[model samples]
Target: MRFRMALYPLLGDLKTICLTLAYLYGLTVYDASYLALGKLLSGDVYTADGKSSKRRRGAK
Candidate 1:
């Protein structure tokens, strides 16, 4: 009976750790995906139409 009491708390702690790990993993994946999407959205691309007027670093 005494051992069972000790085991209960250990099991609860293990469960909590597992849950926290999963949440952090999900958060990291979301952060990575967000960065990828931002990069894709903010990239400079020229279209077939004559609408791009990009400027260089050193030019009049």
Candidate 2:
């Protein structure tokens, strides 16, 4: 009975850790995707449809 009682809290903690890890993994994946999209659609690289005419380094 005592062991079972102790196991309950341990199981709860394990579940919390698993959920936290899943959340962090999701956040990491989302961050990577956001950066990839930002790079892909960034300034005059793929199109001239940008909203600004700002100059970049080493540009004429």
Which portions of model 1 show Cα errors greater than 4 Å?
Answer: 1-10, 27-60
**Per-residue accuracy of model 2 over 1-60 as CA lDDT, tens digit each:** 355422222234444443444354443332333323433446233324233213211121
Model 2, residue 24: distance off in Å is 0.7
Q: Which pairs in model 1 have colliding backbones?
A: none
Q: Return the top candidate by lDDT.
A: 2
TM-score of each: 0.25, 0.25
| Candidate 2 residue-pair clash tally | 0
Cα error, residue 31 of model 1, in Å, equals 19
Q: What is the lDDT of residue 58 in candidate 2?
A: 16
Give the 10-residue window scoring lowest on summed lDDT in candidate 1. Answer: 51-60
lDDT of 2: 0.33
Model 1, range 1-58, lDDT digits (tens) per residue?
A: 3554222222344444434433544333323333233333464433242221221111
lDDT at residue 10 of model 1 (Cα atoms): 22
After superposition, the stretches of candidate 2 with alpha carbons farther than 4 Å from their true spots are: 1-10, 27-60
